[model samples]
Target chain A: MTPIVKPLIKTEALTKTYGSIIAVDNLDLEITEGEIFGFLGPNGAGKTTTCRILTTLTKPSSGHAFVSGFNVVEEPVKAKSGIGVVPQYLNVDGELSAYENLKLHGMLHGMEWGKMKMHIEKMLEFVQLSDRASSLVKTFSEGMKKRLMVARALLHEPKVLFLDEPTVGLDPQTRRNIWGIIRRINQERATIFLTTHYIEEAEVLCHRVGIIDYGRLIALDIPEQLLKRTGRFVVEMLDDDRSKARFFKNREDAGRFVASLDRDAIIRKSNLEDVFIKLTGRKVID
Target chain B: MVGTYAIFWREMVILRRRLIRVMASYAISPLLFLIAFGWGMGRSLQVEGMDYLTFMIPGLIALSSMSQTFSIAMDINISRFYWMTFEEFQTAPISSSSIVLGEVLSGMVRGMLASFIIFILAAAFGIRLNVNWALLLSVIFNTFMFASAAVITSMIVKSHADQASFNGFFIVPMSFLCGTFFPLSRFPEWAYLIAQVFPLTHASSCIRAAALGMDIPLISFLVMIIYSILFFLGAITCVKKASL
Candidate 1:
């Protein structure tokens, strides 16, 4: 038998409770190295809470998690060093310039002059904000701020990057630009763990995704596998009365066509949004 | 230690930018109080057989430094919680103890500067220092105790309203009852006992005694030292347990 490679990040029955409510409940996950793992959930669904636990910002109520094999609670400094987190809120120091933000981030990780300067420049360029590096963060657009945050996270070149809604509010172009940066980072062989409600983003960028609702992981698999798992064929039309009637009348015909078509053609039409609503009875925010 | 120094440096740089405003508000507040009390009411009443200015000046300096220290701490905490700029530092590798240490150290520095400024103004008013280096150290010790006590109060505060109301609950009470604005002998005997429960009274007694070149009680000195240590520990503990 071929040897198995250990996962870079793992959690065993990880749990966190706030007062009477459980923010994260018995979450067990194993993320292999060098893959973009999307944690899909609606707001208040424990995505940020789980990320906070993994980042060592808050301790779990019970159970344990590890980053790069270092326990989050026992070796928080090592775990923090191994993982980079970009929070959903813009936690950038608005008074500081873009370059100064990265410089401060490097200093926080104990990086000094020679290496700090090189890493700051490289990370800024990687985010395509090198030209605006000297401007104060308060002056930057929302897109620019998000990009700078990514650069700040990459300053120490963490082994695992955790981004919570990295593209919450931005133009389509800026969002695509961010996706490109994420892809480039994955190409460099870094493990990426990001939480997002954007189904298309997860479908396009993630090698694997975990759908969470009510603080529980309802589904976890590759996109294609998840699509195959949910009934192979879905003949959907507009929600108008005429479209609904047409869809119902042609359902049998569509099924026969799918059956007669290439055996490899699973003809699955369920988008991630549809799968999420079916699982949670809540709409995934566009 | 290096992380502590870095935090200190960052605070100093920020204060440097706002030096003029901080100076005018904190250091100058006590000077204006001294001028108003000394010249305004110097002839109105006899204060314990000594010049009223002599007794009131040390207390004002201590009060000013204490209030300034607490306000600075409260502002920092409020910003850390509400504005969330403190997340940057909290997420850093620096320990929680270092964060409180940096804040306490900076508060002490500011308190010392306020004391020194008041001392100069007193000199200009012909309130001779009696040239005792030991007395000077005692004044600084008392001032630091006052500042540390305020810092402790600020650290325990949970909300912006708590920060604002600290003056009503603590600062005003300390000022009026602990001989900052007047001698406690003027109050009823029961009131005097109530004032003694607060560490500020012992601190004011120590600094006031030393400033007039009078011998301070050994018990008062020890009590002030104890207050400083206790409040320092309390402040550090509060800060360490706080979440950013």
Candidate 2:
């Protein structure tokens, strides 16, 4: 097999601190080109901070990162040119129409009128917003606005796109629609770096998932590998009135039941939520 | 820059759609100030060669720029937080400098438009069109400078409550001490120092001096330039440090 290329983004001891609290701490990370990398963590686990630093939106307190072969601190504009970010909060101008927004964004990158018009039409169509191209964004539904946000981000044809909780407030159907758009971007060879708390979202969309807790990377691998390595099938039965005496009596039986199964399998209950709790020593808030 | 022009064009179109409200807001205060302050002062003793209305006309023009430009600054923040229009700028490839320039340029356009309307009203009231090219240029330069300063003010603001603080602490004080409603000669030494710190002082003095066809001091011009540079730098720094 051909050797895989080196990472497009590399970080060494990257840290961001806010006052007395550490937002992101001593993180070493690498993200390859043409791959969808998902960051999964509970709220306030520094997922957004990590994304902000990589996108050149916020400066890190210490250490450094490189994007598209340019250092974020030393060559921010070059690094910024290679990235497009869709923040958790909506940033679309309600006053401008869908076309106007895309046109302005394209112009910012110095695209010519002829090429911009053609590209704007194609992108609007790609996001299924062609019908409402002239409608004011303030009049758009949450889903429609979200789609336009994606279209605006893609106008510059950025090599890497960062999305922070892209589907946080959307309905399930809308969320799925956004997922489809993300997948399409991936197919077109744009590397995606998204931060999401939804495990199902990471499992469905990300090529590789990184689980961060307390500002540190705890697990980073394919979703299947994580479940396979740390999770087990759980057999839940009704609790009896036999109490502690019966519980001790059934210990041997439980051991035999576990011994009868495949060696690779363990008779234990564990899911993503369980894994999160086990690692963080706190119950998953949601 | 091309990006700044694009943003400026977009802002113009948005303002066009809200033309009725914008025009109404612009006309309301000048009319009220004309009827109330001018009439109230006219009933009393005559101050100088011109009527109270004529004296207040230039003041009204400067006030409109101050109020409108600062409000535009605040409006951008409100739109970013409540309506989410800021996302458009964030995802776009434009530099923060371009964003700041675009917004300030739009405010400058608005200020000039309102000031022109005040000039027309003053002419209708039999006030002379006292044209001093040098001083008029200074007034305009200061007006644009203050517009940029207002935008910088909004960039540093953390909440809606900051709007009141900005208006009460900065805008009101500057309007008073900067000679928007009175001449700079009436201000004391320390007050003059505080007044010179803002671009508005240069703006109001330049306009007032122009209306009377009086020569402005070279020191005022130098101070305005210094204030303009400081305010422009403040705006750039504010945008660079903004998290959202």
Candidate 3:
């Protein structure tokens, strides 16, 4: 008989409300260990709310959330200690050195002095910030500050790591660097749950993507599978500033559709953005 | 708790980097107050069987501690709004109570440091009041109460402008009217009764009594202890309920 494997992170009918509005509605999720799972959504699509609940920053109105086998609301410290989070915003203290910030985080995680010191050094080196560890964070550039935040989050070596919009507002080079860092961390057998509105980011980084819309999960599958299910090809025809697109399962069919168009048109491989637009009839960014 | 210690340790590291400036700012107001009041109201103007300067020094000590500790709100606001560092504390493995306790302890440290500076300034002016354990206790209670108030205010206010308005309406009035610069007896019966409702009034009264070698008012101590406990609980609630 096949053995039953428990998920590293699990939520059962998780619901959150603010007065008359529901921010997260009856959400259920199961993320297995060692996979880079992405929560894909537009702005205000409840991705951050779910992340906040799992990280113990916000309480779910009703439901159960377990991280590393501990219930988040019932055992917050236990659950929180097992997870690390890099928030969308740069939350690291500008007044503190990178070393001091990590030290403080280690202390909050209840690490001993000797162990924490060693971990801090390792993390600084891992993020390629060893040389600037003693410098104040405000003096650092955006990319450097992001690297420091990554270092700070990983200092405790949490079992599950959450990255919320980790590369938003970054230059292309910095974004790629962070993607590489994410890949490296996941390769080390840590389960990573990341949220992003960037469809390309979700397509490239996530092993599996869970698309959320209006506080509900609309799709969950491997990125390739989602793309295949939507269509393998998309034909585009541009009129003024607005472009209309149609999906086809194969390149031949897509090319035939583009030929039938009367205006300027092109055919391109389908991406997650095409899949999202197909699923919801709305652009991922819109 | 280890979490509390960690939080306080971070505060100390940040404070240490700005130690010189912080200490200088602490001394400036009291120096100005002494120059303006001490020479403005000479020794011939006695208050409660003491020279005006003697009575005013203890008040300055109380005022210094209260103002210094309550200013923790600004630091917390900057962390929440601009630096966003306080979110780290929220996401940390620490309990909400532990976070509040850590910040309150940091406030107490700042308040004690400011009071120490005022004591030095008083000594330099050749004015010495009775110093005892009770004085330290009073200052600790004062900071505990005001620092907890700071946490609540910082968490609830949505913007820096709201914080400024809070300081304008609440802190500024309390600083001058709550027996920090003058005894409550100077006010009318109705105004004195109103001032008595403020925690700062009790704090300044306790500190002044301790410095004057007068009997410690157990009633005022009880009032202050209750205020501290209530405010501490409120601070924890404010932190736990906070979301962005």
Best by DockQ: 3
Q: Residue by residue across B139-197, what tens digits does model 1's lDDT show?
A: 66665665566556656777778777877887777876887778888889999889888
lDDT of 1 by residue, A1-286 (tens): 9879788889999998989999999999999999999999888888888887887777798989998898877876667767777887787877667987787677667787799999999998888889988887889888888899888888888889998899988889999999999998889888999999899999989999999887899999998877666543465443433322111123466677656644333333567776786676667773
lDDT of 2 by residue, A1-286 (tens): 9997878888999999999899999999899999999998899999999998887767899998898888887776677777877888877777889998888788777788898999899999999999999998889998888889899888878899998999988999999999999999999999999999987788889988888987888888877666656544443333353211111123355566656645333334345555565566654454
Q: lDDT of model 2 at residue A25?
A: 92
Q: Model 2 chain A: which ten-residue window has the lowest total lDDT?
A: A241-250
Better of 1 and 3 by TM-score: 3
* Number of the top lDDT candidate: 3
Query: Could you tell me the TM-score of candidate 3?
Result: 0.96
Runs of candidate 2 exceeding 4 Å displacement: A1-4, A236-271, A281-285, B43-45, B186-198
Kindly report which residue pairs in candidate 3 clash with one another: none
- lDDT, model 2, position A23: 90
lDDT score of residue B21 within candidate 3? 97
Evaluation by lDDT, superior candidate among 1 and 2 = 2
Model 1: CAPRI class = acceptable
- Candidates ranked, most accurate by DockQ first: 3, 2, 1
lDDT-based ranking:
3, 2, 1
Q: On DockQ, who's better, 1 or 3?
A: 3
